[model samples]
Target: MAVLPVCQDCCQIVTVNKNGKIETHSPEPYGERACNASGLLTGRVRDIVVSSALRAHAVRRSRPTTSWGPVRVHKSGLLPRMPDAAPDAMPAPKWLPHLKGGTLASVTLPAAGWLGVWLPGYAKPTQAYRVEALTQRNVTSAWSARMECWTVNNQHFLSVANALMRRHEKILVGREYNPREKCTSSCKAARGPLCTCSCHAKHHGGGRWMAGWCVAEEFGTVVDGSRWHWMITGKA
Candidate 1:
């Protein structure tokens, strides 16, 4: 004899024999009535059957969609091999060099007033800055019609430089190369022993001078003082 699942509505036990016969036992007086009302005997178990079907359908729908068909397991492993690593999980290349000792610019200002400096050309000033820069620094640049130049706050020099670096990284996403090797078209054109291309300049210490020049133009040769002013101005 084999035991079937217990009735959900009532504590009823059902057993089936090899001779194609079924026997039901009710634990409570109302068990038989509850089973009958549920149409268990008449094979009209609508609620139970429909709920199971709906659950199966939901599970099927919830599975992630992919171009490939259903996965087949093999004795070795999965059919479509999993990647060793994901793109985002890879380590980011070092781009900017550490700051050295010096003030960014050569200028004098009142203890409270803001200093103005022209934006550097290599910084690739843009009308719309990246969201990272805007949210982190709240740094904004202005175009001076009289001077015909773009100017930013003296304190926002580093933030702007960082934003430019990020932008350049995004632009040259797939073109990443080993710094010691000539990888880009520009590097090949220059016929250099090492990567002397724009990508190299943007990522390596080669462009640090430009960054320092921009800083000097904006904040002057007073790194600690400029940083202190930035903190006091509520912009830090």
Candidate 2:
């Protein structure tokens, strides 16, 4: 590689080979120094540079892109993981009826022909039903149905939809109505934790808070003001 000396008066360039033989003589000299021989402008060096640039461009196009940031790749699990959110930050969900893991307050008929309803508390169900919560105080019998209560509590709050199947119905699905929130009370009912409401039945505007539904689109509970807790039916 060589940079020629320009004739300052006429701006003409002169090049010389390693043997001091005049290789190139220019009438119009370049304002800047010439590039490395066989590079930048033409030859195998130029082809290599162009090839590398094209490869980088193809890579950019091939990958999945997002405005939010880089794409995350991970092995999926059998059960979908939930979306993470901050505590107490209840921004109206992009989709609704917000969901969370809660305690099963009751499994009741409430009326004559209503499908059995499961009332889950926002607070994780505990054996300490007698904990002076000032709501279900009196006529004791805290936990009625011990229907497969998990000592390992369910998720607190979460979101979904990313990597969800394009079809709507397949993504958002539900299991049996029995969320089975923990219950440590000693109400031993022979029939799988199924019972009628008694103690906590008449708290607050209990009727207004009951808004649970069943798998068959059956309108489930109808009460509203049970002070314990209110969460979504059918965990996502």
Candidate 3:
């Protein structure tokens, strides 16, 4: 006996024999088992393809919707009708305190001032980061609890901490970019403005009391990782 499954998009039928092997067929033969699997995970071979398709679909669906149907423009610069909100009608971020001078300072930074050291085998850390606190200046206001420095609410303070560290030595840090296959080895993957990959070439790390409270990286690319905050906070 044979089982057939139809592709959801192409409407092409695939044949599966009793041994669970598949073959492509035209006009889908009868007297064979057919499964309606228009919306099912077929096999591991399709995981990546399916993920890419789903991502594209999400991007299409999330696009700005227009009140009117699509418009057609002519060489004369005329349109059938305005399709959506005028360019000026788009929303903007609400007013907030200037980041330059916010009282609370927190931002993820490098561990030991070194940023782009590739984990062995591109290994992902299974545990949280480990942060050690070393205090300088007045003991009365010294940072005692390491956890206090890493909370999301304390992003500003985290920035301050990183700035303080820059005064000491080169910091290891990675720049963030959507991962792409551009940089194979020497250069690491980095996010680009429009989904294209860019070379975030690592540079020498820097140390200094730079801009308000920002750690100056003298070198190394700044690739954003899923565990970036964990790496920065040293929270393990």
Which structure among the candidates has the greatest lDDT? Answer: 1
How would you encode candidate 2's per-residue C-alpha lDDT over 23-54 as one tens digit per residue? 22212232121211201111111111224544
lDDT of 2 at 225: 24
- Every candidate's lDDT: 0.28, 0.23, 0.26
Angstrom error at residue 167, model 1: 1.3
Task: Give the runs in model 1 whose Cα sits over 4 Å from its true position.
Answer: 1-137, 147-149, 169-236
Clashes of each: 5, 12, 38
Residue 152 displacement in candidate 2 (angstroms): 22
List TM-score per model, in order: 0.19, 0.16, 0.17
Residue lDDT tens for model 1, 1-236: 22233333343333323443223323234221112112224232112222454443321111111232222323321122222122332211122111221111111122332323321111223322422243245556554443233445545444544444332211110111233444454543442112223253343443442342222111112232222111101111
Lowest lDDT 10-residue stretch of candidate 2: 38-47
* Model 3: per-residue Cα lDDT over 22-63, one tens digit each: 332221232121222212244401211324544433211112
The local lDDT score (0 to 100) that residue 70 gets in candidate 1 is: 29
Q: What TM-score does model 3 achieve against the real structure? A: 0.17
Candidate that beats the other on TM-score, 2 or 3, i.e. the better one: 3
